[model samples]
Target: MLKVFLVEDEYIIRESIKKTINWAAEGFSLVGEAGDGERAYPMILKSEPDIVITDIRMPFMDGLELARLIRVKLPQSRVIILSGHDEFDYAREAIQIGVTEYLLKPISGATLLTAIHGVAQKIRADQSRIDYRAIYEKEHAEKLQLERTDFFKNLVDGKLSMSQVLEQGQHFGMDLSAVWYQVMLFQVRGRDLAEAVRPEAAEADRQALEIEDTIMDLVAVQGHAEMYEQIGDTLCFLLMAQTREELQQTETSLIAKMKKAAEGSDKLLYFIGIGQAVSRLHEIKMAYQSASRAFSARFFSDCSGIFRDTDAGFLPESDQTELDLSRLNMDKLDRRIVYNFLAGGTVTDVPDFVRNYLTGLGRDNLNSLLLRQYVILDSIFAMAAFLKKQGISAAQLEQFQNQFRNFNANLTLDQAETRLCQCFDNALALRDSQSQQQYGRLIEQAKGYIDTHYACEDISLSTVAASVHFSPNHFSSIFGQQTGLSFIEYLTQVRMAKARELLYCTKLKSAEIAFQVGYRDPHYFCYVFKKTHNLTPMEFRSQRGAKAAVTGGTDACG
Candidate 1:
């Protein structure tokens, strides 16, 4: 119901108007009444009514002044002028004050009722448009975020040339031009969801997501870095600065924020790998590769902290020519280190893991042919055993051994490390390929569910994940990895696709189409339609019709 406030000097007129209409029955609520504008202003401000009906020529705080104040403070409220005099000046001033209705006094209550009804309908329509725009803006923002994610992935992946990167950066509103640039990979290492119990794993995933969100928020607040969410529970940030020193400072500040974000959560461990600062866009690939190598340090160290390009390698303290075997740390040669690394490492970890493993065996000891051969056989058998535990057949293990049959003590430490990296890389590749098959099936199931239920308004990440019997966070990780889009982005894609088909092939109005394809607000639906296709529904339909007419095919539905 619309709230109505009244101000008239004559009590008799006010009572008569109030008595004439039963406010409740007329769909109006007569909230307050005053004898004059001075008395009415405060009451009107308090009630914040939708309609203000006032007598124009009052003693102080006249109708014009009240209307002006309302126009400034409560612009949404409509005003009606009641005047005893039929003067041109009063009507003109009322119009100037933006009054909804300028009624000469001695008016009946029926005239006032008609004016109020019109204002109410206008307010409802205005509110609907406001709501529509809000929804449209939200969806547009989400779509832009996903597009930015893809752009960042391509930017660091070296799939785009320098010119292409700059052009695409411009399109996405990212200023890629910088004097110095660096890439940082922020990773969340928590409980292994596959090995962890269900409830505990889900809780940890939730906490990890919250921590990541906090770090992302911090990065956004800094304004110099651009952060993108990646698959595998990682955040990729591109930090830009005017000079190398400034870039170093930016990296330091961001790492502090990240560490603070991880402070309270024991279950949520994090590592940040910052690459070297470079001066060109194309060099971002080199920076990212170095950052990734640094990131893989966590596999060997199993510690939560920041790593840098210098931390990526495992070099001996001195040249092997001056190395002392007497000072060798036999503890580093423990076979469990290699076994543990193999059990929980990725292909990216192979190089650093191999270097660290070989260095631990004593660089000087690697010169003794017997010890060197023992080390090689130990690593080879470790890989064989790891692959076997993963269910590689005896025949497959033999095939794996065939690749290394030429291995001997003739290899230098560098050569031995290189060969070991290759072996670990192959084993991890096989393991990942098997894991990918399972992930592929889960993703397909989730996508199928989303396709089937895209028209349901309640469809969401949680709902789709539940359908596939996975936790929401875990599903989110794999969904992005497999599809390159978040759950919300994928759902919007499905809804928009359906909306497009309806707009092109059917005679339904946009609102009806919105309802049929999961949007509750028709105006919002139209807004997203325009944003996605650069044309409103009607415009798209007309464009399609024009094309069909040119081609001598059936015209699209009007």
Candidate 2:
């Protein structure tokens, strides 16, 4: 309720006001009343009323002076002045003194009530804005949650530079210049294929998060761990320990506690790949990578156990006689099978394609289980990154995860293979539902827009993406994927292609050609043209009659 104070020099007028208005019904409390400004000042100050009504002409201090004093002492209070003065100077001075309402002396109760109601509405609005700010701040704080797995993933994946990482880490007061840290990667298997098709995948992602919460909650009590989520069905955690023994003890505690937590849960099963401890903060990424690689161990699918990369027996003796394959043994899979699957192949044998890929990977390490898991997770990340840039989002990735069943203590090899295949089928179904045409059309439209507008100096990725009704980021990804070129590359290609035609066919100077091709800075344009075509405008024009060397490939397409 608003607290209101009344100060009037006229005794009859003050009593009439006090008696006529029902302050309670108006949502105001009549805390105090005064006859003169000087006498009322201290009382109103003591009462701390939200609103004050006073006469401009008084015995001691006038209303303006009282208001000026109140403005300093209680700035939030609203002041109303009732004065008979018709002088322009009077109203001006009241307004300057911050009076909210001013009325002539012969004022009606209804007129005063109107002013009060207006002030009340304004006060409510101001209060509501204040409350909204408070609520916004709270929600913003919630966005800074400790479990920002995506941020950590980016950090480990080398997406952020050291300075960027440090600057972001500073917002949360994290000092990354630590002596020792370990990365924990957990690969979880969810319930059968039928159960994981939920809206949020709250059930599948839960397996990793559950172990994460259990370990982090306990370790947080001791201030020893920080964790973040990464791509795929994995969560990465960094633990800080001063001593090797403490690190070992912490890992042992985490393993034991997490195992106990998942004892009866039939919906989920998980195992952690613990990376070797590293001394430098920058080396933490290496630790994470090692942990990520460790998740591929084929021999260790025991019930929610912890395995460290530093363990002597963790990796079998290397045979190293075969070809040094690519990231996560992609070389193991037959190119045709992998390409067929990736090219939106038939769903009937999609699992076989995946299983064939898994079976093909070996590097003297006999741990087929670990190798298979590694390849699968790595393939998801790789394929997602690859497909996302083209616009066919890895929308099926999560759905694939739902159907994917990796090895677990409770599952046999045949059961694992069956589930893995089921996962692929599920993935194919989701992929089919979202055909390439969704973002494909957008990319085509974007390219056409760029082609039409390339000569405009202001043409940019954001503008082109906007023309196609997609975000710059999404447009960039899809544009890159569809054309096998980035937005900038494609845009530059179009400009250069036009510039080449202009250079070869017309007599325009380098600068004019540059301008016509959307290259505002001629020297910069020369640099880019040289970079793209290995020839300056003059050189390219000179070579127009020579064997059209750079004109046959994507160089000509651009």
Candidate 3:
């Protein structure tokens, strides 16, 4: 309540004004009433009322003099002078003495109340400015600034629990009890190289502050939002809202005004990424992370437009936007790509596999740039295993490790994916080159054994591989690469060639030829013969005999 003191020489006027007006109802309290300014000054000094009302023509001392004294003693207090028509000059001098208002007498009680109410408002405004000035000054102190910056950064990083937040927020001058919050990440973009460098960095910082002030001005109009902190180039905001819709309305207005203000400078382009509303203060960190990635996505989206966590698909699929690793299907994503490549699958599907990973995370609204990187890193073992199977040397493995170690040097999604794909490509290329060198000779030796042993009924991949002192599995792999056929397929072709030769040259019985050509079963031989040439072995022989007879010539063999 505004405290008001009355100083008037006429007892009837002072008593009438005091009795007729409801001072409390008019937002003021009557501290004391005096018969003259001389006696009132002492009472005014004791009460130190926020507002004063005085008659210009008073006994002993006058209103103008009292107003002047009040100005020096308590500048925050407001003075209202009541004067007669003849005292206009005195009222003028009283105004010069810093009186808030000068009203002529026989002033109505309503008019007098209006004068007091107006003075009370100015007095309160003066005090409010002092309070705010002190707050800002204390917050700007270097020690407090550092502590506040670290506390807010850690809170957003999920390094602080709710209890810790409550404990530390008080010291930082934050009312963390406002549990409901929404966050926004604003990134000033498209800065030229010159502006980004040292010579213009100060200007850039100044412009950033101006932009902050403009945004704050818009927020002040709405009266619900507050500036949180600036996280590097991004300005973070923590808005206290009672409902999701209220938060959205506040954000929409803030962004529109900000965009218009930014249009004043083409170089001042910016984008805003808004997070979903959270119910508790501790959840602000999750909201901030969501907004940060949403802002990053603006590069591929509307670069200068406001994007929400939902709009950018930067929050989890559920209403719960909190970060949790369990919700990520990274294992499923890993399987889609060839984590274990040498176990024999092509990585031609890599790009699509990565696309799926991106889609899944976006759909779930997971802020996953770092998560994607970790997925790539976690597959280091797969690359090592592929290298070991290919017989990559210790030196080669070290060289490959160097590339993977530096893979995260740049963590943007595209840059990181490119690095990961390059690693896979290099490793696969090396594996192929190594396989040709290590298995090429053993494969040739195995082929030579198969050619000689075509008539041996027990000839098999294992038997031939043992003759060349190679494991069946190892020899099979080598044979496939060198001959474009498996060990079993190459052996079958060799036996078939020998069977066809016997049928044409010796006029041999089908069963006898089949037995000599590594087939213990004549029926199986006839089936293989017919399938290979579209005719049984006997039919092949008869057709050739007829052709020889028709030509009136002896068989070519004879």
Candidate 4:
């Protein structure tokens, strides 16, 4: 119902108006009545009525003053001016005050009701427009965000010319005219890092996503930087400033805010890398490249923190100038590093893992042909052994070995790094591929178990998941991903399918069919059958029977 407030100095007139109209029956509510504008203002503020009807002359304040105050504070409230004065100035003043209606004294309730209804219609229309715009902006914002992210990616990858970048930037409301810009990359780690050893780490990925969203919110509220997802698990921030010093300040504040956000979740660890500030728009690629190099340090570093491009390699230039065999602790160059990384690491971890593994072998010592050969051979042996344990085909292992047969000591560090990254990338890819195949087989096993036992009313997700040797949570996630249905949903579908088959081919009552399909309650089965097929069990059978008769075919159940 539309709310209406009445302000009139005459007590008898106010009472007469209130009693004359059954407000509720007319789809209006007389929320409050005030004798003057002074009292009406506060009452109006409280009720927030859709319409305010006030007389022009009052004891303390007039209707025009009340309408003016309401127009400022409660602008959505429509004002109807009831006046005894018929002068043009009074009507003009009411119109100037933005009054919805101006009526002379001795007005009937019917006129007031019509004016109130008109204002109510306008109010509802305004509200509907506001709601529609809200929905439209939300959907459009999501699409625009995706487009903007793509533009940012192309901007950094040097795929777009400076003119194109600036034009598109302006179209997106981003001013790309800054003098200095820097790229920063940050990654949030949750239980995902531990998932290799603990496959049953429930909700780990979900927690990491929540943490990433929170960190993104922090960056968004900063108003000094633009952030977007660069790739899986890594978020990129492009900070622009008028000067390099300002850029540095923004980077520091951004890192601090991000760290603070991550601090809220004990399960989350974050690493941030800030690149060199560049002046030209085209130089953004260089900045991003540098930031990515620094970001890779996350795989090599001992703990979560910040890093820069300067922190890439081990040993200073002075230390690398001499062959320091005495300082080269053979224990530091453990082949277990390769074994552990291959077991737990992903393809993205290849570059940094290779760099760090080589760095640990002593850069100066690696210059010796014998030590270089030893390091390369040791890494290959470890890789091949790990793959063998994973059941890689003998032929594929031979191919892997033959591919690295040319890895000689004469290769430069750059060449060696490239070769090692390729080797590890292939090994990790093969490992993941085999793991997927194994999961496919496991899902098939689980499905077979479900198909056999679905008739048991006591069967459940835990029981079925256990039959296939999987944790309930992990099984639930994989089941949905593989079959596009939850465990319960799939089970229900199997039961319903069987129920339909029995109903069509067997002369069984509905209750017996329900029991045979694992449903204990006949009424619940009927309800579910109707909800799923949009017809009751009896209705469906009758319809099918009628079709059979029309075709001159006998029902098997009949």
Note the Cα lDDT for every prediction shown: 0.78, 0.65, 0.67, 0.77
For model 1 the local lDDT of residue 302 reads 45
lDDT digits (tens) for residues 361-393 of candidate 2: 543432344544554555455444434433454
Q: What tens-digit string does per-residue lDDT give for candidate 3 at 60-145?
A: 88888888888998887888888886555676687678888988878898888777777776766666566445533532453354
Selected candidate, larger lDDT, 2 vs 3: 3
Q: Judge candidate 3 at residue 111 and give its lDDT.
A: 83
Which stretches in model 3 have alpha-carbon errors above 4 Å? 1-142, 170-173, 177-180, 193-206, 217-222, 300-303, 311-558
Candidate 4's C-alpha runs over 4 A off are: 19-22, 196-224, 311-349, 363-419, 427-558
lDDT of 4 by residue, 1-558 (tens): 889999999999999889988899988898999999998889899999989989989978888888899999998889989888889998998889899899888888788777777888787767756654653464355446656877987988889998998999998888888899899988766523523345444445445556676777787677658877754457789899998788878888988887776665555567888787889999999888778767765655435689888754665423344457786877656555576567556685677667766777677776666676677778788889878877788998998889888766587666767877888887887777777787789999998998898878678776887786554445665676678776766777888888888878877889898888876556667866887899988888888878997998876656
Q: Which structure is stronger by lDDT: 1 or 3?
A: 1
| lDDT top scorer | 1
Best by TM-score: 1
**Model 2 score (lDDT):** 0.65
Worst 10 residues of 3 by lDDT: 336-345
Q: What does each candidate score in C-alpha RMSD?
A: 6.6, 18.0, 42.6, 12.1
